[model samples]
Target: MDIKQLKFLIALDETRHFGQAATRCHITQPTLSMRLRNLEEELGLPLVRRGQRFEGFTAEGERILAWARSLMAAHDGLYAEASACRGQLVGTLRLGLVPLGGFEPMRLLSLFRRQHPNLRFQLFALSSEQILEGLTRNQLDLGLSYLDRLAREQFDSLELADTRMGLLYDQRHFSFTQTSLNWEQLGSLPLGLLSSGMHFRQSIDHAFRSRGLIAQPLLESDSVHNLLQAVSAGLCCAVMPLNGGLEVGNPHLRLLPIAEAHTLAPLGLILRRSAPRSALAEACFEEARRALADELRLSADR
Candidate 1:
């Protein structure tokens, strides 16, 4: 069948409503209905069960929808490859990043644009759940997130950095001179924590539980930067990833490593398993790999 007809079927399957599907496909309801009717006529079977409302697709329609998604993905891949061959890498590269992953996409973007100046990049700061959903829908080209609790089969992962948990406190308030402190010591102090939705926060909570302690945060925030700001203001201390974007110049802030024997978390790049790489994607990937290697070597030297 025609590619447009296949697209219509896929949209219908996703939305399960004629008007909503037509809107998604950027067509009028009548046009979508006509296309579906013509497709069914060509196949000599009713593709959808009609009733008072848009009920559901027939068995053949369900099968067609599956094949349609695969076909559309392949078609898009071919277009991307052809565009790359023309020396014009011109398409939107969508990326989702966790807020605290220490990924400097700005650096990657600068490098990518120098090579593929025509490419467009769309970056979203999203939760892990949204990143996975965007990848499944073929909306995102790459994701940067924590590796904990990730579903391995759905995406290919490349470890980019080791993120260590640490206590961020105002040195003046605590009079702590050492570089790190034990978990038990932290438990004795009032603290601020990340809100429950963030994966980093959950990891911190898990670390506390493993030590037979409870995390009772006097203040909680969804924003990592805000949490750091609070600590700088001496509102309370917070446990955060060492690689979180706080700089050393933030006079009131000090990063103290968590004393739990091992507290490093893996931060990485994730891409759909079936996604074909574009010139821009490959360039960004290579830069990330190089940066990760440098980080590892620095840690070894230390």
Candidate 2:
């Protein structure tokens, strides 16, 4: 019936127990129960399925919970905007980033922090698919991931980096005179790569297939750092982008460019096409765009 009741519903969903949800809302169990009953009566629909324990929400309850979440999100967004107009930004920005984006997300966050010191951020390392789903579900305000990885989703994206996959290895362990490598040559190396479930790995696999070669990774991990560590320890060579990676400035690991790699894709910032963009989200997006432009400029200079 009211935001208070909606808050109670969210707490109930989270705790899945009447007593615990009531405690979280700082209300008595019976009062919480009464409020829930009133809410169901107002809606003229059976929301909660009551039993010996806190049964899960009924079909209508689930639908109401979805709207509750969205209403709460927009409500928070409005308050944040109001604060921003008063010359302060105070809110938690939920950001989902693919591991491939590396520290770019952090770097972007760092830049935003300089301007809006009061705003906090919650960053999640996710796959491109997960990022897309998170955006649709209103779980994430923004995402840093491959623009092309998402299919059948309405998304607005700003390309953040022109990243390319390359061979990462300690130069001391390899015999490569040239900086760029041919795709066919990768078939002979003991490689450390991402798992097949990851879009990054899928892109690499597709590239190998196009070259009539099968990628046989000696070490497969979902974490980019794991693959990088494998390469660092001279365990195997890794194919990946050097941007925002630990090896970028490391003297020992040489990022051998894949001269004609098809695995490389434009990494970017994405928002749900129809979702409302908060002021903080817009500010961060602009900062990200600036950072990407600087990166591209530096790459050109190099």
What TM-score would you give candidate 1 relative to the actual structure?
0.66
Which regions of candidate 2 fall more than 4 Å away from where they truly are?
1-58, 149-153, 171-175, 248-252, 262-264, 289-302
Root-mean-square deviation of candidate 1: 5.6
Per-residue alpha-carbon lDDT of model 2 for 33-103, expressed as tens digits?
99999999999999999998898999999999888877877877898889889988889988998876533
lDDT (Cα atoms) of all candidates against the true structure: 0.76, 0.81
Runs in model 1 with CA error above 4 Å?
1-79, 102-107, 110-114, 171-174, 261-265, 275-279, 290-302
TM-score of each: 0.66, 0.76
- Clashing pairs for model 2 are none
Residue by residue across 1-302, what tens digits does model 1's lDDT show? 78999889878876889999999999999999999999999988888988876899889877766666767766766777788787667666778887666555566677667767877888988888888876776656788877775778877778866667677788767668677788788888879987887777777788789889998998998787787778877789888767665646777677777776233357788777655444455556676677668878998999
Q: Give the TM-score of candidate 2.
A: 0.76
Q: Positional deviation of 7 in candidate 1, in angstroms?
A: 12
